[model samples]
Target: MATLSSFLLATSLVLAGCAGGGGGNASGTAGGGGTAGKPHVLKVANYFATDHPQNVALREKFKPMVEEKSGGSLQVQIYDNSKLGAEKEFYDGVRNGTIEMGIPGLIMQADVPKMAVGEWPFLFKDFAHAKKVLEGPIGKEMTDEMESKHGVHALAWSANGFRMFSSNRPIASVNDFQGMRIRMPNIPNYIKLGQLLGANITPMPISEVFTALEQKVVDGQDNPIATLKASGWYEVQTDVLESKHMFSPNLYIINGKLWSQLTPEQQRILEEAAKAAADYEWELLEKSYEDDKKFLQEKGIRFTTPDESFRQAMETAAGPLYDEIYQTYPWAKEMVEKIKAEAK
Candidate 1:
């Protein structure tokens, strides 16, 4: 039997080959320009399943648009299901130009901690407000900082939906979260949030979450409803609380070196395609969330809707972290204020 580590390694190598090997040429001409025969192959990596809305948009919409606009000058190869690597690995691959593009998750906060401000517990009014703040000046500033400091260019940001808590045990109120062992991504802000919520934070990669849950290593985990369903986490989790505590947006990033290598026309095509794909995915988010919720209910996962008093208690508990975040990341205060001002 193949171990998980070995399976991941083999998958990475196979996908790497597919990304690097330009199997065919539209024409024989060879040059930087997208002339007759020389086509620029852009490899895009994502951790989502092939059926996920984001992947569907990339493969069906983004790829076709970029290819058509480039007039056979560009070919896009997408590696879904973490074929390239995990979220952090994907970011590293893009930064080093091993991968041309990736939609790395909030792990991007490691590069630009100011992004943590956008994810404050119960920050935005809803998804539309979150979208507005991100697509506005605040998002641009974050993108600029990333490109300037991290050597990765942000193409566009798309919705990852609001994160909710799922547990093996019922969590009907804020008091129920006290001392609960909760699995969280290994990111500073997330750790802090879990701490503020009175959870015994257990940081682990997303891939290990299921096993952790089944073995009862952690009492609960949090993710968007769609993610819980898509990842089959509902099978392990019995109760879900609609905390809607954080709104996460996935950023599509390209290597700075790779971006610089592209012709101005090529860059425009890629950027436009990314934007279009982002919009398409955002359109699907609400429906996907609703469908996933229905699916979970049908599968017998108990759901909890927090009362106003419970929500207030959660907010009160997490509010102090705002000052802590500002102290840790100097720019975070300003970004948080900007996003709050923009949020409806």
Candidate 2:
């Protein structure tokens, strides 16, 4: 009888322990103590400053929409101001899944050589033409190639606007570029374009540009007006030439492995959010150009609008590069032709 009573007592104790453990788990799940599966965390990186339109859209619109749509199952963390890394490092991080997403600037050509065609001097007629080509069949082909060749997926194409020359001296004509020391990004196409324009090239990171201009390390730098204003280059620059030399595009990319890990519903939500952010950023570009130009004028910067003859001179000088580009990358010519045809 004692043994029977002891067995009953042990069984009751085991049942009580089970019930206690289950109750603890329920409490944890209810109180957000991680008993429920942890939400997936996505890290997005960009080199733009926080106040830049792209970052603003990503942080304000993209993040909230994604979180709300996912019902707290997904969380987006943005690292702006190159917090994650510089352009090349950001691309590497995203490709390797160390960073889930990135919007890298001119450094993309380092990974996919054919991408250089997109930034070819005088290639894009205007923002609308550029957008139409990049968002159409040609863009899809490039994105597919990116996925197949590199371990990255392109989500959207956004712009950095047309690059203009900012300098201490006025550039009213092509002759004004003679013997000028200009800061170019560490990219071959940029170097080539600077050389073609008869400027002494000083290849440097974008971060060093302002100091370089102030200290006279470089006579001038070329970038979108918004970037020039945002980087405070206008403080040292007295004149801007509306060259519209290159229309730089920023690609929102995701790590292929990380993308594959997401559920279909989650992927759809992310894709839609990315598209919305890109569209919003595109709309901001026109306003940014007007606002930045006005702000620069307020700061006593003079604007030089180059005439058609000057533009024609530039086109003639840089046109030979098309053949050189075609020879260098086997697929480049075809892509360039496709974009050109689409633009028309």
Candidate 3:
């Protein structure tokens, strides 16, 4: 009798533990705590400021959409303005699975050289053209390589807008570029572009840009007008040239391991939320340009829209840089051709 009672107690305890596990609303695909019916936490990181359209889109669209759609099984936490770390830091975190998600610029071009095309000088004709190419088949081709090589999966493409030149003096033509000190990202394309334009390039990270501008470490910096307003770089810049030399885009990526752990329904909800948020950011950013330009003007900053001649001159000077890129990467030439063809 005693032996039978012991076996029965053991069986009862085992059954109770299994029952306590709670079958977890399709989170059965995940391991450990996630299978115990706990809400899966996803941390989203980015360097964009809180008021910037990127953060606004994430907060208003992504968070609410994912949580509601998952019926409280998925929770999203967003860290904006380098709250977690700078672009590279969070990017590395995502790649290593330390961070669930990140919105980063094409900094991955350092590892994934093909990504450089995203920022090729004078490549994208306009906002619409860039968006079409990036969100179309070409973007998928590029991002597929990213998933296979790197450990992150691309969710959606967000807006960084076009790169504009901001300076203390007017840059109305190519002549103004000569001997000017300009800040550029350490990326070779950016440096080569600045060098081609006859400026002395000071390669630095974006985090250090404002101090460099304030201390006059460099004469000017180039970034999207949205970034100009978000980072408060406009306070130091007295003039802005709507140069639109390059179209910069941000990517919403999730760690491959974390993404794989999500159930199909959870993955679908996250992907849908990402696209919605990306579209939201794009709309908000486009509408913000004129408002940012107007605010900069009201702040005693001069805004210059370069004429067609000046634009042509800059593009002409950049021809060799593109030629050199084609020589370096066998696939680059074809990619550019495809991008241009698709733009039409």
Candidate 4:
């Protein structure tokens, strides 16, 4: 087995091939853009704010390591806040080989519907369980499938934790959600979950979420508390219902054709850098939850932990949606079952 260092070296070589011409931009060379001898410049596209802790953590932890290890041979250029277009657009860009890499949601069904298998609502019990499945065999299989079917290769999996609910009105039970309009990702499973819980679901891009709440386009939205605080949604919505629903797992993907063309040494470097960033980002996410909640609390955001009965009720109501997902992808169902069995 190749070590993590070997993976980054191999990835660097792959990136070099994508650049076509041998010369490298000074800005994209090494950390500051090195000389022409550098393998390739890595353009990393993400929709998060440049200052967001996760993004900061990723850069602080991974970028320098990749550059130094590659001896200023790989350049990493990060574009934040949808500079490379939104999540779906980034996915398409990677597929078309327009973008070298991006971190996109599993819900991008248009580009890779099979990847959406992991986003089925309420599939995970908690964070640890989520990590087990995502970093384990099931995720590996899906990652392999993505490379084969979509010309995308997964470098690592990052978490957004289990998503929760936030609204202007206090949401203590499923009853409180009745007639509420909740903004959700443009995914069928999300729509079904809202419907199951008696909320009118409004599907939209993540960028529009805060605005929708402020404009009353939706009465509520579901996401991790960390996101609600980080994105400044608390300014518009005062009440938070901590209903850990779906675990939003993001994929750090590179164009497969581009990745395959790299020399093994360069590839090794990119993989090492990605793994380090993944671990760093996840740790930041875990720590951010408490700090985020505390900050929201200080800002006068009301936090409501729903009763056990309500959680069970919501899960039961949404259970049928799982059946629909299973019907859509029987192989994923099998993989999920195997994961559940192993968790025992």
Highest lDDT, which number?
A: 3
Task: Identify the runs in model 1 with alpha carbons over 4 angstroms from their true place.
Answer: 1-38
On TM-score, the stronger of 3 and 4 is 3
For each of the candidates, give the backbone clash count.
Answer: 1, 0, 0, 30
lDDT of 3 at 116: 79
Per-model TM-score, in order, reads 0.87, 0.86, 0.89, 0.85
Which candidate comes out best when scored by TM-score?
3
Q: Distance from true position, residue 80, model 4, in Å?
A: 1.5
Q: Per-residue alpha-carbon lDDT of model 4 for 134-191, expressed as tens digits? A: 8887778667667777888888888777788989999887888899999988877788
Which wins on lDDT, candidate 1 or candidate 4? Answer: 1
Every model: Cα RMSD to truth: 14.3, 4.4, 4.3, 11.5
- After superposition of all CA atoms, the RMSD between model 3 and the true structure is 4.3
lDDT for model 3, please.
Answer: 0.89
1 versus 2: better lDDT goes to = 2
What's the C-alpha lDDT at position 35 in model 4? 26
What digit string (tens of lDDT, one per residue) describes model 2 on residues 141-239? Answer: 656668777789888888888999999999987888899999988898999888988899998867678799999999999989988887888899899
